[model samples]
Target: MNVAIIDYGSGNLRSAAKAFERAVAEAGLDIAVAVTSDPEAVRRADRVVLPGVGAFGDCIKGLNALSGMREAMEEAVHGAGRPFLGICVGMQLMASKGREHGEHRGLGWIDGEVVPITPADPALKVPHMGWNELDFTPGRHPLLDGLEPGAHAYFVHSYHFVCADPAQSLASVSYGEALTAVIGRGNMVGTQFHPEKSQATGLAVLTNFLRWKP
Candidate 1:
């Protein structure tokens, strides 16, 4: 199987590609992982991964700059039912809009908006960085198959996803207030944290994602 890790000129492409490569090997899978900006490559892949590590507006701008990239992703994931994963700001792009710098349109894959994380406590900081434990239903989703309720994942973001439907929120983390950690619907799934940087928990999720059918 072919897994396309889209290179939108925004995310940690090399690191993410390496993580997926390791996951594929560890999982004993025959998937070919490609880091490409080619839209056709995405269209032909069995699975698609979108990773981002930057401001929401900047990331979206980079994505839009790639001709046919969004449409190809839409065809592969939405039209063809292929499993899709979004990481960091890539996940945020699945929302209806992002409120960073200014209002920006998103892929609208999930019913949500990307807003700044406002912790109720003054002690908590913006750009909620570092490792945090996840709160999720262990068996609710296949992606979390081996992940426990409090699995720690690396997160670094000032913004968070606010889901319109709670059911779409597969997991969350507390940074003075509850922030979205994972979101999913149908063949699409997203992680607010960097699974590539989360070490064991990250690898486990990546492995599960490799083995995931939906």
Candidate 2:
């Protein structure tokens, strides 16, 4: 299947690319990966992976600034309803707004805000770094395929997605509180953590995305 990683000039495209390649090799699946700022590529892909790093506001602005990319992304999210996997700030972009930098609007694909993870226990880090166990709910979509309830995955983010619709949520992770780890509704899937950096569990998420018939 064709997969395109939408690079809006603000992501570590190389590592994301390599991670997908690694997953494809391991899964023994024929998949295409590209760090494309190209609108045409976004339109043509079977699935689009929107990966982002840095501040939430900046990422939204970066996505908005893309003349060709903006329309194409709208098409991917709205027109085609193509399979979407968002990483870190990319996931945050799915929200309605972000409290990070003066309440900037997101893609509005999902209703929510990306807010600072005010740790219930100050001892727990704000970024929620390193490996953490992901607990999944029962009878969800296929994206959680082969992933156990206590599966560990890497995380590196200060803020997490507080979704408006609880039903959209797929999984959660404990960091003082059970934070929303992943959410999938219809064709839109957002992850508060970085799957590319999350090793095998991360690869499984991507693999599910590649094979996802949504």
Candidate 3:
């Protein structure tokens, strides 16, 4: 099977690709992982991964600039029922709209909005960087397989997704307050943290994604 990591002029393509490769090796799967910009390649992939870093508006702009890329992704993930994973700003794009810098439209895969994080504690920072322990119900989602509550994952973001339906949230982390960490609905799943940079925990997530049927 082939897993396509779409390169939409955002995210660290090399690092993300390397992480997926490592996950494939650990899982002992003969899967092809390709970092592609071609819409056809993304549409044909068995699994599609969208990784992004930077402002929400800019990222969405870049994605829309690519002719038929969004449509291809929609067809593959929604129409074909393929498993789709989004990372960081890639995850934010799944919301109905993002209120970063200005109003920006999203893919609307999940019923949510991307808004700036406001820590409950006054001492906490805007960009919730470094490793944070995840808070999740065990066995709720396939992506969190083997990862119990308190499993650490790397994070670096100023904004977080707020699900209108809390059921869509797979997991969350405490950064002064509860912040959305993982989101999943049907065949789509997303992580606010960068799995590529989260070391062992991240690798486990990627491995689970590779073998995930839903």
Candidate 4:
């Protein structure tokens, strides 16, 4: 199988590519991983991953700048039903809208809004950096196969997705209050943390994604 990690000039592509490579090796699959901005490459991929960093509006702008990239993504992920994953700001882009610097539109794949994190305790900070535990939903999700409840993942973001339907949230993290950590709807899934930097827990997540059927 071929997996394409869409390079929209916003994220750490090398790190994410390497992690997927390791996942393929560990899973003993003959999958090919490519980091490309080419829409044709994405169209031919069996699985698609969107990884982004930086401001929400900026990431969206960069993605739109690429010729045919957005259309290719919609066709492959939305129309073709290919397994899809989005990480960090990539995940935020799935929301209906983002309230980062100003009001910004997103992919609207998920019915939600990206808003700044507000900790119930003032001592907690924004950008919610460092490691945090994942609290999976009761039935959990296929993308979280090998990961257990309380498994920690690396996070570094000022804003988080606030899903309109609570059922769309697959997992969450507690930072004074519960923050959305994982989201999934049908064949698409997203994570607010960097699986590449998350150690064993992260590796397992990547591995699971590589082997996931839907």
Candidate 5:
């Protein structure tokens, strides 16, 4: 399988690559992986893995600089209707707007905004880090198949995805309130946590996504 790890100069591209590589190796598939900043590579991939870190506002800016690649990226995942995975702030970019560093627009692939998790109790940390349990409901989706519920995944973010349609949410993880941990609407799968850092469970998730022929 050929998996394309997109590098828009703003994501956790290196770590994402290593994670997928490790998972692919364990899965016994000689997956061809590349960390590409080129948009054309994204359009031509068998599977697309979009991962990001840093601020959402800047993430959009960096991606916009590569308009051709960005256009291709938008089409490949959101437009061309291919199987795509988004992580961290990359997942937030799937939303309509990101309110970090003022209001910024996202891909609008999913209807919602990326907002800071304003905890009722200020004692709650802003950036929810460390391993958290995923409250997933088993589905026919290939991404979740064979993956047990209440599995632990690593998370590191200040803002989280607020999906417009709750039915679209595949799973969620609780920190203060239940944050949208995963969203799988059609061929697109978005996650707020970093599966690359989630160890075995994380590897299994990525492996499932890679082998996901749908």
Candidate 6:
């Protein structure tokens, strides 16, 4: 199988690539993972992963700056129905709009908006760094195949995706208030945390993604 991790000049491509490599090896899958900005490469891949770091507007600008990369992603994931995964800021880009650094347009793959996390407690943090528990929603999602409700995932973000439809939320985390942790729609899934840095829990997520069908 071929997995293409889009490199639109925003994320830690090396780390994500290495994580997928380790996941594939452990899963015993014959998979070729490529980190590329080439639109055509992404279109041909069986699975697509978009990983991003930094601000939402900046990430979207980077992706749009790449000629045809955005179109390629839309065609591959939206038109062809390929399994797609987004990590951290990458996941936020799936929202219709983001409130970070003013309102910015996103991929609109999911019906939601990205907003800054406002913890109810005054002492709570904004980035929500470190590890947090993942509380999976009822029913099974292919991406959560080997993951349990209390599995902790590494997170480092100030903004989170607030899904418009409750059914789109696959899991959530509590930090003074409940926050969306995972969102899924059909073959597409996204995580607010950095799976590459989440250790075993993250690796299991990547492994499940490699084996996921829909």
Query: Order of all candidates by lDDT, from best down to worst?
Result: 3, 1, 4, 6, 2, 5
TM-score of 6: 0.98
Q: List, residue by residue over 119-152, the lDDT tens digit for candidate 2.
A: 8786886777989999886557788888888988
Give the per-residue lDDT digits (tens) of candidate 6, residues 1-214. Answer: 7999999888989999999999999888999999999999999989999999999999999999999998899899988989999999999999999999999999999999999999889999888999899998535687887777899999898988999998898999999888999999999999998899999989988998888888
Q: Which stretches of candidate 6 lie above 4 Å from their native place?
A: none
Tell me the TM-score of each prediction against the true structure: 0.98, 0.95, 0.99, 0.98, 0.94, 0.98
Residues 89-157 of candidate 4: C-alpha lDDT, one tens digit per residue: 999999999999999999999999999998888899886999999998545787888677989899999
User: Could you tell which candidate, 1 or 6, scores higher by lDDT?
Assistant: 1
Model 6 lDDT, residue 114, Cα: 96
Candidate 4 lDDT score relative to the true structure: 0.92
- Clashing pairs in model 2? none
lDDT of each: 0.93, 0.85, 0.96, 0.92, 0.85, 0.92
Q: Residue pairs in steric clash, candidate 5?
A: 11-52, 75-80
Winning model by lDDT: 3
Per-prediction RMSD in angstroms? Answer: 0.7, 1.2, 0.6, 0.9, 1.5, 0.9
The digit string of per-residue lDDT tens for model 3 on 69-150 reads 9999999999999999999999999999999999999998999899999987889987999999999999999999999899
Colliding residue pairs in candidate 6: none
TM-score of 1: 0.98
Better of 2 and 6 by lDDT: 6
Name the runs in model 3 displaced over 4 angstroms.
none
TM-score comparison, 3 vs 4, better candidate: 3
Candidate 5 achieves a global lDDT of 0.85
